[model samples]
Target: MIPQTDPKAGYLAQRAEIDAAIQRVLDGGRYILGEEVAAFEREFAAFADARHGIAVASGTDALILALRALDIGPGDCVITVSHTAVATVAAIELTGAQALLLDVDASYGLDPAQLEATLNAWPATAARPKAIIPVHLYGQAADMPAIAAIAEKHGLAILEDGSQAHGARLNGIGIGHWGKLSAYSLYPTKNLGAIGDGGIITTDDAALDARLRELREYGWRERYVSAISGMNSRLDPLQAAILRVKLTRLQVDTDRRRAIAARYDAGLADVKAISLPRTRPGAMPVYHQYVIETENREALRTKLSERGVSTLVHYPVPVHLQPAYLGRVPLGVGGLKRTEAAALRVISLPMFPQLSDAQVDQVIAAVRASV
Candidate 1:
């Protein structure tokens, strides 16, 4: 059976191309924010359909730096999903802003209805929320159209967490271009991942773009006189080079993911006791993780494991309950009821572009038997 995921298969497939990229970076001594990083930023910006792409140290820093660029700080609250990676919430806290935890819907993204309800029910006098950070959880784009409308109505900014979605799209717009700003993770596991930590922030706003360029660096456009207390987060040239190579193959890799997902859908749609993840019409998902929902999640996982099929939980705990965000105020509706329920019941199956059809069927058979 195909393991839950394998990052190396695809990397190994293009070992020679990847090696060349690495060697090129190594030979080029300018390591930080050098030509590779600058070129990648330009290419990534074009790919995302945004005016700018600011490279950074990691996805977490991308968010933190974005917040700092927007001047969101102490006493400011950021509305966001509590069912996301702890990084989403942690980044807000790092910027000294309060994280208002929101719930996710059955689609494994932000719940539009819940988001509206929470905004309506917010206790007045709470720190006037300056922004909303909706996570594109597990590679699915959050309901950006709805969220965008809500943010506009409430004057809240949008910062998308697009860590898992490199090629994911909604209504013809890529995930990174969906919100005012999107934070992308090139962590080794992401769809268009780098060999190591890397991140980019995409935005159409020129002013914000300029600010972030300064914000991600030493805040000095000119040779480090320090314009702000910006941290030392910069994308290394090697990661940028590698990611550029990876970026070129993203569409092809995403197509393979679609093929594998379709295989799973074909095999398991009628299977009892499990509900496959759904992709809404007008959206194209990259299938970063083919997660399934079922009440008997643990049992199914155990059975799959025993059968040599690897599985993973996208997230086992809702961000609100995490110690770091404990007692945080709720941002969107009832503080993650659906998220909590989904967390307990969901399990991600084997997924990768290079997975063979035989391997797909093996995983399907194992899952069916295990379930």
Candidate 2:
């Protein structure tokens, strides 16, 4: 069956380069945060058009560190959407801050209008709203211009969660440009993925850059000296080496993903049963997962599987509705109506750079027949 996403395919596509990177790391005695990790950090930072990059162990750590760097914890509230990877909310909570969940727009991003309304009606007794983590979900940018304007008015910091949006842009600028700092997950399935679990944070602020480096390694400005309270979250050298090789090809890969998305758009436009993914005006999404919404998601998923095509739900349940956070996590002013709707309907079709034109046609055909 065609897979929803193929990380292994990514490896196979560049096997020789990846193997050489691994060999290079093995040859170098230092296995931890060595030259490989340092080089990847620099390369990725340049790619993101940021002043600095701090490599971390996981995407969750990237968020946590970004929050900590900003001193957002306990008695602090961070606004983000409910329709996202659990890691987004989990990272905020891990940082000891309260997560105020919000709704998404039609493009499956944070609603700027809701953000304005929520701040206007925010209870005085509630945790002080300190930051907004606008997740660039599905590699599509949130309405940063509107969000940034609202943020500026309210004195809230913007921390972009660009986990899925490696090469995405809005109004001629990168997704992370509007925020003070941005966090990205380099998971095996992400656009600029590492071979294993990895993450990175980028920022234009030199002070934040230095603080993030210290925070990642037990507050180590000088070795073995605990300068401040921090945790251990360093990117592995082996993964970093592999990512360096992958980084060189990200733009080409992103172009291929866009091509596939265009094909899906043409092929599935007439399927009345499904709503195709939408791109915002002046935005260029990298198509991490070409998701479509259909009320009969489970039925359609089953049908596609039966027809030898695989699909997966971007998120089967909204974070607030999940058992771990139910009845506890706060919601925005109007509640997560759009987020809840998306959870029940959205399903991600097969999406990856390696998918050939013929395979894309197969997926489109299967989707047409199934829907």
Q: Which is the leading candidate under lDDT?
A: 2
What is the per-residue lDDT of model 2 for residues 124-157, given as tens digits with 9 covering 90 to 100? 8765599999999998999999999999999999
Per-residue alpha-carbon lDDT of candidate 1 for residues 29-95, written as tens digits (9 for 90 to 100): 7877877888999999888878889999999999999888778999898888877778888899899
Number of the top candidate by TM-score?
Answer: 2
Model 1 off-target regions past 4 Å? 329-331
Q: Candidate 2 — number of clashing residue pairs?
A: 0
lDDT of candidate 2 vs native?
Answer: 0.94
Give per-residue lDDT, candidate 2, residue 143: 95
Clashing pairs in 1: 4-350
